[model samples]
Target: MAYRKDNLRTVKQAYTEKRARALGIARARLAELHRTIPELCEIDSALAETGMKLVNAITAGAEGITERVAAIRAENEELQEARAATLRFYGYSADYTDVHYECEDCKDTGYVGTAMCACMKRALSLLSLESAGLAPLARTQRFDTFSLDYYQGDDRLTMQANLEIAKRYAASFTPASESLLFLGKTGLGKTHLSTSIAVEVIDKGYDVVYASAPTLFLSLEAQKFGRDSDIHIEEAEDADLLILDDLGTENPSPLHVNFLYRLVNTRMVSGKATIINTNLTVRELRERYTDRVASRLLGEYLVLGFVGKDVRMQKIGT
Candidate 1:
């Protein structure tokens, strides 16, 4: 619901393209019908002229004009019906000349009066599909691909713990939830868990932003330097869920520290849920961000500690 002007433009573009494609398909089918059944074309031509006749009859205002107009309108309806029937005879469904839009109420216009139509919601979902990098993430984790078979009995305890926590976190996700921090070493399935949560939260129809630390920080830096004021901050603050992966990977600077603090602080105050996965330990986090920032995270966040030998190495037989 809280979409940007550009996002609204995306919705409009999607709607326009969908409606145009439907109209194009109907036009093509009509043309095909014209080629196959020439009488259908004649009926369509008569239906087109009926409007002119109705207007002329009303202007002339002769007695019995109402009955005449009604008769002409009825004939026009019958012509449309006959044309549709001819198209059906040729294997197309009824309503051959109609646009076959997703939303009949708005005809893919995206809005009805002041309210958003169903087409707009579909457009937003479609836009998210195009913008979010979901395919690659999904390909990596087949639910069937996960196996306790490889887990090292007691050594496998780490992944087992994380798997349980991650599953519960995903299942219990609500809009009014606290932020999450997944702290662990490399190849500990932190990214996998967080990205999985991203997919789940999106399914629940929440706007979620999933980006690595470097990419997000760079975008924030660009927005800061550019004349456009605080675009990244607004996006971060307003998104229903923020999944910041690889938290310690970005180049640290005073600006970065300040920006992060402000971003975290604002999100915390607003009670927006954020999920941050970091390789930094509690001490390193304190060193990078000040004690206040680190302490607040420790106190407020639901920390899910990731443990285990690097799974990537095991996969590569290292």
Candidate 2:
């Protein structure tokens, strides 16, 4: 599987250390067992001699190799039985000194043959997700954690409806899922619910990219206008759920505007899902961005309006 340099470095380093620790444990166990059991020393020598015999027989293409190999295996099995008995007599399990690896297929080396082990694949995905800066929200912002009690008056019911929509959107999210346009005043539950949906959409095995408008635009601009970057804007734009938080909050620039146009248009053309949370009303959006960009969003996205007193302000005395 393809991996980023940072991801490769981190995952490979961890797997290498795991292999080292596994070998270290096995060696220590064998040494202790060899010291305690005199019979084991003789059995070990005999086993080594039989292994060399098999190697020589194979190298010489010698006749009677099959019979000789069978005899050697028989001898090893007998010796293993004795070894197991010795451990059992000492009140230890048969596998007590056996090295335990997190992945039996790879023996914790992170690969079996030429393919990466499932353990390593899972680790890579999990590590990538964790390092993507969504771990904090994974704990706090979930559909279950969202409270309707935070709203009051008509704002309360509006937020309740918004919350349900967000939940359904998250539950059913896919690469071709309907894109949402979250328009509202600041401090409504827009950011909170959008972030919560992002966490769930990620859990559903989609690459969900979450970033503020400034960070998203500036980084892309830097990659384009300055040093060549390993971080690609395509990764974000092509994500399954691209949540652009706090839109229109970033400083205005032709480069930022152009990048935003490209980002939004590319996703739209590709049928990728995007959720944009902005304080700008529909009228304000048209004025802030170019008419073309505004029309694209207004035409393509499913608009969801959020209305409520600032939840943050309501929480001050509570």
lDDT of 1 at 5: 51
Q: Please list all clashing residue pairs in model 1, or write none if there are none.
A: none
Worst 10 residues of 2 by lDDT: 1-10
TM per candidate comes to: 0.70, 0.72
Which ranges of candidate 2 are over 4 A from the true structure?
A: 1-20, 39-95, 103-125, 228-231
Residue 169 in model 1: shift from native, Å? 2.7
lDDT score, candidate 2: 0.78
Q: What's model 1's lDDT at 175? A: 51
Cα lDDT computed for each candidate against the true fold: 0.75, 0.78
* Residue 110 lDDT in candidate 2: 85
lDDT tens readout by residue for model 2, 1-318: 234356667888999999889888888988987898777778777768878877776776667878877877887788788778877887778887788888899998888899878788777756655755566666666678778887778877888888888888888777888888999988787777887887666555467677778777767877878756434577787677788889999766777777788888889889899989999878878787878778888898888888867778877967
Number of the top-ranking candidate, with lDDT as the measure? 2
- TM-score, prediction 2: 0.72
- Which lDDT tens digits does candidate 1 get at residues 1-318? 434456668678877898899899989978887888888878878978998888887888789888988988898888878877877887877776677888888877778987888667656654553345444674565334555545576647867776777677777777568888999888877788777776666655567776777777787878867845323656667777887889888667877888778888888888788988999999999999878778878888988887767878888994
